[model samples]
Target: MAERYAISSGSAYEEKYGYARAVVDGDRVHVSGTTGFDYATMTISDDVAEQAEQCLRTIDAALTEAGGSIADVVRVRYLLPDGADFEACAPVLSRWFGAVRPAATMMVVGLLDPRMKIEIEAEARLTR
Candidate 1:
């Protein structure tokens, strides 16, 4: 069996919700739906664009710990309560994903917190 490892962002929700921020199985890394909340400060920005940037930052850290980077991302999912906010985040998304060109999906859905404007999840396969 392949080794399974879990990574934490030190978000209280990870402990309260009983889910890891990311999990690595073999060479694959699965990142959870990450919000804008900075784990270190436990603070979030009201602007959707700022939130989107923060989400990617968190995901990148998790991927790096799993021996990978954003370029290794093969799949990505974007969730937001307001579809309109998606446009504001497009540039931030493109900055991180443009060259990598991962399979992607976007959905408008309610989040656990009303303050959360967006959530992102990603899957990556280690190439090195």
Candidate 2:
């Protein structure tokens, strides 16, 4: 069986929840749902576009640690607290993913944290 590995960057969630930010098994890397908070301050921005940018930054770090890159991403799932914010945030997301164009889904849902406007999760493959 292929070995499994977990990666983290000492974020509070990993320390408090006892979970790695991401796990890699075989060729697949599964990243946890990431919010738009700056870890240094544990603060989330109110602007939807800024929040989306923060989420993608975190995802990028997680992917890099898992030996993958954004280009290797095969899927992305976005959760937005308000449906109306989709248009406001879509351009930001598209700018980040313009070149890669991975499979993606976006949905409006009630977030666990009321202050959070967006959350992002991703899956990537490490090619041989």
Candidate 3:
């Protein structure tokens, strides 16, 4: 079996820690938890909706690089700093997942970064 690892742009996986953004094995790609931080500015949006959008954008980029697309996603996990933000960000999430309705879970938790109110993680399979 061949194994491969990847680190997406704007990610500090190797520098901050020592992990790849995604690891590929066989037909599966396990993407790491992705946050909505603008790589260009190294800043995170204060709004939950914008943050969610940014998180999905980052996840999409990782999926694309891993020989997968949003359609190939099997599951998604969302972490929100406040439970109240769920409704505020749900519409954005629905729009992003309108076509690909993968299994999903959203929860409220204290995040590693205080300014970050949302983080998203996903798993996808390589198709063809």
Instruction: Give the TM-score of each candidate.
Output: 0.98, 0.90, 0.91
* RMSD vs true structure, all candidates: 0.6, 1.5, 1.5
Ranking by TM-score: 1, 3, 2
Give all candidates' CA lDDT scores: 0.97, 0.86, 0.81
Pitting candidate 1 against candidate 3, the one with the higher lDDT is 1
On lDDT, the candidate that comes out on top is: 1
Q: What would the per-residue lDDT of candidate 2 be over residues 15-85, giving only the tens digit for each residue?
A: 88788778999899898888898876888998988998998888888888777787888899999989888
Candidate 3: worst 10 consecutive residues by lDDT? 6-15
Q: Give lDDT tens digits, candidate 1, residues 54-75.
A: 9999999999988899999999
Question: Which runs in model 1 stand beyond 4 Å of their true positions?
Answer: none
Q: Model 3: how far is 94 from its true place, Å?
A: 0.9
Please provide, for model 3 over 1-128, each residue's C-alpha lDDT reduced to its tens digit, 9 standing for 90 to 100: 56667645567643586666677776787877777787657888889899989888887887888778888888999988888988988899899888899999988888888888888888888885
Instruction: Give the C-alpha miss distance for residue 68 in model 2, angstroms.
Output: 1.4
Clashes of 1: 0
